[model samples]
Target: MGFHGIAKAVCRALTVRQDGPSLYDVCDPLLLKYQGGDPHLGKFYRTALGNPALRPLLRRTGLPALKDAERLTRLRAALTAARDDAAPDWTAIGTPVAELMDDIDVRHPQPPAAKVTARAPAMADIDRAIRVCGAHLLRSFARNGFIPTYAAFNLLGDADISGREMLMALTGLNARGYKNSTLLFALARIFIAHSPARALINPPWRGIAEPMWEPVQIRHRSAYYDAFFTEALLGFVETGLASSDQAGAARRAISDMVEFCLKTSAEEVPSHDGSTVNVITALAPGPHPRFSRFFAQIKQDLGFGIYVPDCDTTACAFSAATQAGADDPILDQPLVDFYRGYQVRAGANEPRVTVPLNDHIDYEGGVVTWIDNLNGDRPYGNDLDPTLNLDILEVSFRNLKRWKIIETPQRLQTVHRIIAFQRRLVESGAFKNPRSHIYYLPELYSAYFGRCYAAFVALPLAAQRIIDPGNVFALIRARVLGYVKDELIAHEMNPFDAALALMALAHLNAEIATFTPALHCIVQNLGEGGRRGPYKAYEWNKMKTPTRILVGGPEVTSAFALMSLALARRRMAHS
Candidate 1:
């Protein structure tokens, strides 16, 4: 009988329920009809039913023992003949079934026996990484008057630093000497380019005007850029880094950008509405009370919760809620809903849930063309969205605890689910594939995976139960360490990936010894003008190779490198 027929027969014979308690439950209704008419068949069915779990095994293994009266008589005569001849030949029954049985056994083999060792990093190693990365940044500044937008490119090229990248660069050079001055001058050039006549600050993409800096255009402009720059500029004014005129200009620009973003209708605002909400929330507590009002208004219009249409939107919402305040239902509901939406029931338990980071495509698209949204509510599967999902989990865990959004039991359960999902992905070798998610290139996989590892380490102790319930932590730790050893140490590391890897190691409190070689590699690869090499390449055609495209300029690379080193230094100090 075919497997389906066998399943039906077995289900009927065993009185098993269809759509039973668990996913493994199997049933059908025909065998009972045969059993009612024949005592012999009923007796055979009772003997063959065996274990509930093993019952399905017979379908694939075949029913060699099951025989009609005619077959049984023939088998008995053959056996008698063989016994008389003193040569029992079983080959006449059928080809040997041992090979098939062996294949079945192999199909469900045990998990691997490999154990991963976690290495502790030393303070000296961290210090060395910081020193090397810092020295590299200084070297680049000495070679070029201004940092190139990309580590590998000469001049600014097509890339320009966003306000957020600029802010990070400024933060990195806050106390440094001549390098600080160069950074300030670079900031001044940007301010000059975005003067009233140019009107580049609030536009979709701002380009640096020629002569002073590279003439480069930035697209997908939004209020977030303005808010980030405003925050940075105001910081400069507070530190007395900016002159009176510069401060005045910054204040005016901040006011204008805020007005532009808030006054415009939601329909009128650029595509990334979630980003707009996040930027506004980020500015809420900082010199802009109006930001809070705008945040509330947007939330009211969009409804209470993280935008489910995309992972970035959900992540941004979680981040905004965490930053907003404590016990605020408006901000907290979205996170709670988001967590609930992605939770999947596991095993026989209703409460036992797992958070699988599944991908959802919002639209289809070309490189430069906008992704067409044929169906906004539907989410098709892809391999790349999991990175952002993990990102959301990381931010959610940190903020939810800090803000006390949910109860302890619920929070722990959510954390456990996230960890389980991550462990399954890593063990299944999904991370090894270079599938494109948001970015066009496969190289971004490592960067996102690095971030996922960082998130794993950032979880609280209750949420990080890898030893008792499972050794998921050790497995993830091994994979992360291996990633750093392979991608960061063995190969040339890009600033973005390097930054992410460094942050992951720091978060895990991994031995600085493990990452020192990777840090050194980054230092060695530092191009002229305080930059790193081979920016992320994006392409439209699947068959065509993508060109190395620089993003956010030298400031981004330098900022990330400095931030990584700084994080390492801070961790070492505390340790």
Candidate 2:
């Protein structure tokens, strides 16, 4: 059929009544034609519609372009057909529909408008954010002295970020005359209680020999917690708020922890190369200078080489070495070799280095797919794995120069190549597109994007231009502003996510105006005892799932809120 003929057929099938819902919201004919009679139609629909390959065709054909009235009409019709028909060849319809739309767009060209500058934040707005974030933090502190990480219907007791949150809150509050000494004391006790006892012998198992701090209440132990708790304890000790004995004990615990990690039989230790480095880095800043032996032992055991299991581990290790004044060119050769092996060819002329978050790998049709386990092994598989490629680039860019890796021609080329890759990722919408594997939960997305903002800010002006010629930060600023606007109007975000979002904006030095509304909402939502309670967890789609699953409590949420406020205040002062 001709373009007009197909357009009429599709529009007729897709058109909704004036009072009806939007085309996307309504049932589409194409969906019925292809997906009907299938018990798993929902899954099939998402796969077909969300496919990255199909996105190009859809965009080129102008079939599903966002906010295109003509394309919406055709898409609505096709979707309705797929929904209703018992059996239909999706490829047949999709191909023809795409061609028709492509022909139309070619005939009538209408380009999108240029991007605009964002509104700047006002001083009053900054003041309001600090006040609200501070109030929310105080109100969200639990009776048990911990902060809930998320305050939603699904999560209540989860303490994933509890240690870090408490540390940040303490750091922030310590600057303001220790307004919450009771909370600080409670947190100090928790940190000390969680430290591994020096008297205990190392476990014999190869799987469990790594020495790390274990949380008091949580059963699962990870390197992330080990690094976090170590830093928190060290920070607490430095404040001199704890009793002399308590401070001394903390220092001893740190020493013992380092010794245990170093003394553990290398053969028995599982490769938590990243965590070990993090522990060393955290200890490097302490008053004690006994970590040189531990540092040397770690280098011997893990080698200065890059391990594929954790890409950022090598960077962290190098950074720690530099910080401790033990940096050596010989030690960096392994990382150099590792980076050389990890370069990805983007096009015939462009190549970039990328660091995968995990070691999960799948080979399909000669294409290697790196699986991300940021959220763990969930039913949705690797769909939620955050492609932290930009984050890796940022870490590499910020640290490699200090380690002198950038001095080599090959290494400098890799840096330039990665910067080029980062530019493409942001410009091509790979960072935010769900079709690409990099898209993550909104809060996580904000966090990663914030890293990009910070990295961009740190870049030399010339380098910044090479990485982001289009001024993408303006777009990011607009998005964050929109988020703050939405939260102010609806207040639907959980406390942890809200705090994270605030912190991300602060990292970008986003206008204070964008933060005020959300901060106000947080202040208004505070419950009694300065605690925000009952946090949410990730929703499971499995059969017979409970309506609500408690994950975090007041401790995590309160700490995060406090940290967010502190970040905002710091940014505001500088601005």
Clashes of each: 12, 59
lDDT of each structure?
A: 0.36, 0.35
lDDT string, candidate 2, 315-375, tens digits: 3333323322343442344343344334454343121112121112211101111212222
- Model 2 Cα shift for residue 117 (angstroms): 24
Off by over 4 Å in 2: 1-218, 225-308, 312-340, 346-387, 416-425, 428-439, 459-491, 521-559
Mind sharing the TM-score for model 2? 0.41
Where is model 2 poorest over a 10-residue stretch in terms of lDDT?
Answer: 539-548
TM-score of model 1 vs. true structure: 0.41
Report the lDDT tens digits of candidate 1 across residue range 1-575: 34565455555434433221111111113222232232322222232233243344222321222224454344334323322333323233111211111221101111122223245345455444444434433343345422223111111111223332223223322122211222222322222232221122112211111111123212222333332233333333343334476556545544554443333211111132232121122122222323235434432332221212333333443443333222333343334333433344443222221111122221111011111122232112211343544555555655655545355565555656665666665676555443323322223334444454555556666655531168775786677667655544444344445555666676566776665644553454445342243222111111100111223444334445555556566655565
Cα RMSDs, all models: 26.1, 20.9
The number of clashing residue pairs in model 1 is 12
* Model 1 spans with C-alpha error above 4 angstroms: 1-217, 222-309, 320-330, 334-336, 342-384, 402-416, 436-460, 466-468, 521-553, 572-575
